[model samples]
Target: MILENEIGLSSFRNERQKASISILYTYGFLANCYEQFYKMHGMTNQQYNALRILRDQYPKPVSTSFLREKMLDKMSDASRLVSRLSAKGLVVVTQNPTDKRLVNILISETGHQLISDIDSDLYKLDDLMNGITEEEAVQLTSLLYKVRNSLKSTYDNTVTEEQVHA
Candidate 1:
């Protein structure tokens, strides 16, 4: 389906506007797919993301701040996620021995089991990109990186200007 038709818009202001809208729309579509996939496993995408990070770093506890830095969703409250996972017995949280102000988090056996279960069906999630070839996927990734780099400079300039004005 055409993007304009899908969005119910006759046209965009220009190619740039169309591209931006397309990216956002595509992201929403993909996010919805991911949400459904994770929900089937009784977890939210953020929770799964945190678990995956913990799994990768298994046996070595990590801080909530580390999870926040590594999470795909910057808006997620890592501490809250850790608390929720703790409540579900999916993770273990403990006060840092050296730094009482900080807490260490590790995936529990239940968490590891859940992750393994999800991994068995992980190919379904990867299939979401079946519309694109491997080469196109690589190209798309590169393009997104370029876009982020450009946006980073723009964001930095805006923040600098705001600070200066303040």
Candidate 2:
């Protein structure tokens, strides 16, 4: 369905406005699919994201700060996610040897097993994107990167100028 029909709006101010709203709406739509998929396996999307990060770092512990920095949702509370995963035996947390105030996390064997299980069914989530062709997906990815670069440059300049004026 067209964005206008889906959102029940007759028109947008411009194509840029339409594109922006479509991106946001599509994100919410995709995020909901992810949320439901992860929920079935008894975890939030943030928790799954953390597990994947930890799995990649497997054997080598990572700081909660590292997880937060790498997470898809920047606003996620890494410490809380760690605590919950720990409670579920999905992760192991230990005090940082060099810094008592910091904790290091690692995915446990059970965590790895859960990930393996989820991987088998992951295609169901990927199928949501079957509406778009592989070439379109690549183009979409490049366009999204361009958008991020534009935003980042603008934001960096704004912050720098603000600091200078202050």
Q: Note the Cα lDDT for every prediction shown.
A: 0.96, 0.95
- How many residue pairs clash per model? 0, 0
**Per-residue lDDT tens digits of candidate 2, residues 54-158?**
999989999999999999999999999999999999999999999999998999999999998998999999899999999999999999999889988999999
> Where does candidate 1 clash, by residue pair?
none
Predicted candidate 1 versus true structure: per-residue lDDT over 11-122, tens digit per residue: 9999989999999999999999999999999999999999999999999999999999999999999989999999999999999999999999999999999999999999
In model 2, what is the error at residue 131, expressed in angstroms? 0.5
Candidate maximizing lDDT: 1
- Among all candidates shown, the one with the greatest TM-score: 1
Q: Give me the runs in candidate 1 sitting further than 4 Å from their true place.
A: none
What TM-score would every model get versus the actual structure?
0.95, 0.94
Error of 2 at 66 (Å): 0.6
Q: lDDT at 73 for candidate 1? A: 97
